[model samples]
Target: MAKIAYILLCHKDPEAIIQQAEQLTAAGDFMSIHFDASAKSESFAMIRDALEDNPNVTFAHKRIKCGWGEWSLVQATLYAIEAAIADFPRATHFYMLSGDCMAVKTAEYAHQFLDDNETDFIESFDFFESDWIKIGMKEERLIYRHFFNERTHKSLFYWAIELQKRLGFKRRIPGDVQVQIGSQWWCLRRRTIESILDFIRSRKDVIRFFRTTWIPDETFFQTLVRHLVPENEIDTRTLTFLMFTDYGMPVTFHNDHYDLLLSQDFLFARKISPDAKTLKARLGKLYSSRGIDFQISNEGRSLYKFLATQGRAGRRFGMRFWETESSLGRERELMIVVCKKWHVAKRLTDQIRQETEIPAIDFIFDEDNTALPDLGGIQSSLAKRARHRRSLMRMLFEYFESDRLIVCMDPSNLDLMHDFFSDRSMTRLLRIECDFTDDYLIGHARRIGLAGDRTSQLTLERLLPTIRNDINHEADRIRDAGFSRHFRIRQSDSTETNATKLVEFLSLPYETALKLAQTRQLFDD
Candidate 1:
């Protein structure tokens, strides 16, 4: 058997780690976990007990201080890898992942896929031009000055500005520099692991540089891998998961539906008024209405009764009865759209509402809103149409005070709309577009029956969206955003000396060329 070790560095939410570990172990994969030593003793004990039953799980002790950036994370990761490699020397590859990461496919499937590709799936993008790295530097400088120099946690922004003046530096890193960046989660060949460790041992300057950097975790491995391996040996573009977030939190269905569920008395065993008889009677009727013929416990019956009331109230108010919640927190707002045929929209809307936590308002163009209208005085020319559309978008955006907005569209229609909203400024108008095309890949996964539990539905509805102007575009948007450099048509791939032609054909902006070259992984992916 080819051994693959799963390495996780966890600080909080050990349950999530255990959940992920269970999936890996069931797939016949080896596992090693390193938890922050500074966590509460009870939390550690709970994690220890949970993993004790799993023979594959090995826990390591590591002291990690919060706010240490990637330095602490890398330390923990390296320690786990060393231990895993020591015990499983014959292991074919080591997969590094976070506790929060959930596998969309089984480990066996992933292993086979990797075996077929025969490539290391580490994101090897040049990090120097990445917005995250530049932002990290600015954030670190500000935090250091406020907490260390001023001896107070407040005024970090002011102190950062002062320090910048004294040091004669700016927050932005020049795009030409070859810095590396990627997800900490990666699958590495044994040789690659050893090479990285050996290079780190010899590069004292690199270690010193990271000690003071804000997000050392994201950069250290990227820089080390870039230095140790031939670029071609590394598959910089491929990612097993495409993570999207608003307001620095993971978006999930749980967070979005809780509020709407509660408002209608459909959650918490229908215990809203504490009248057991009323709850049971209501729940019994609700079950019958849904064609479900299962007996509920007294508690379960009450809960269902309350949920039915909540569902009725949500419908009366024209609100989404289900939603996926974002992990960002309660302060954010969210909107979700799913592209299906006209009849499918209603079912899709219900499914989306049940699965996500954000408040979703279904807008079926055929049922709720009119199709695109020809704007008066607007010419059909691209420039004229784009300007007019922008004007209309600006007016609509100003009406909402949300920090995030998502526009979900059908895949077939994406190309038609790309020309109207290809500008970077659209990012400021709409932050994310959840294209249903991407969801097709997961259709083969096990299907859970439709849930009508008011409590379940209520939890789904209360979730909100944070981080205004978050955009989720399909592959077309990515292509329009100049990702063409990362890939070439099969025919063009064999052609030599076509760099000029490629650039001209793609119509890439000259200003972004250097940045594109440095961070090619974004396009390559």
Candidate 2:
């Protein structure tokens, strides 16, 4: 087998990294590891012991201690590549891989690809163009120095960013380097890797410029390479395969991505750790549409059994309804819009309806039915004088088979739903909240007083923080029933923000949500 240098950046997950190393080293590849300096010494020792006396393996003495989006990532790669060059002088290709990534292909196939495309530098694309430009992520990612990794510190960093955003301020991009980004994983010829390291050492200013930039590992080599290597030498197609979340997180592949892995010509796939998450991801993908035969591995079966045993006592709701609820391209996504009272629900519902033009089924419990506004729809519309909250929801679910759906509940009346209709599992909840003072003055109590409920005076008492408790209780209930993710919209939020929040909850695209907010009538802010 041809000598390939695999540069693995390991933080935690030493076991998984060991498996990753084992997969490639069998092909007689030289593996160079740079363990995160912050990692437990015992774990690092364990990783070293696992690959002990493997003449093909080398460890970098200069370990870097950095978290996500730090200069340490670049340093670690540099150190690993430097070590690999010194130890495995004969290695033809330098491959950048992560601790979470596993080799999907045998070494023979990988070696063949390397042999065929010897000069092609894998994954060369202009990061500043296309999607990043449209989404406007460059301002946040490229300009800002997001060095802090701790929770509180990161929160403060974002808080300062928000203040800066309001004040119309921009962070300085350190040097005169053409800034761009790309997928961090790549297989490059030995010369390209050496050129990158050389450029870094020679142009300390360029390296220093990228240090304060977010996730510089993705950009540093990519930006510098175009200057060093010819455009014809760069092959934009990456050998590493990945699927990302709405946020750019790589979806952890398990058995579900087995077919995808086989279908691709890629050599590596990332973030495959822990059988449970991978199983769940596979399950989510498999069950994302109409019934397909999916075999459950022992680990998968165990995961399902464990999930079933979790949450509060509830009837086993099959995944069929969930699939229908979660399926993409459905005419309308359903949102269970629960608020404290009639006026509050109307206000929040208006924010959603006006911004997104999505039909909202409001659970308005007006005794005289005069105050509640009419809504439009087929046999399922709640636009006319509303029924009691529970009955409306019961009737809605009876006929509603998950098409453009939302439910509204007042937390004060959660007792009406104790063990009844409301407890039936919803895919997610979007709580609509109002200002507490306004809940008494402009919302529940005021409306109750107008409607002449004998308990109008007590309504304010019940309604105080009633929204939060009810929302929290409902959140707990749904999560207990295994519908864990939820969102919120407060009175303080603008209509557009609320619309985006609701759209996200319903899994609608950001563009579609944005169009709704922009084109739709009566947008808030």
Best by lDDT: 2
Off by over 4 Å in 2: 132-136, 149-152, 162-176, 245-249, 256-260, 276-525
The number of the candidate with the highest TM-score is 2
| Local accuracy of candidate 2 as per-residue lDDT tens digits, 251-368 | 4554554654544556666656355465434422331133333332324223334443453332332222122122222233445555554555555555555555345555643233
Where in model 1 is the C-alpha error above 4 Å? Answer: 52-55, 68-70, 129-161, 164-178, 245-250, 253-525
TM-score per candidate, in order? Answer: 0.45, 0.55
All candidates' lDDT scores? 0.45, 0.59
lDDT of 1 by residue, 80-190 (tens): 887777766667788776654444333444555567666566666655345643222444432232222111111354466568678976444323334577766677788
Worst 10 residues of 1 by lDDT: 265-274
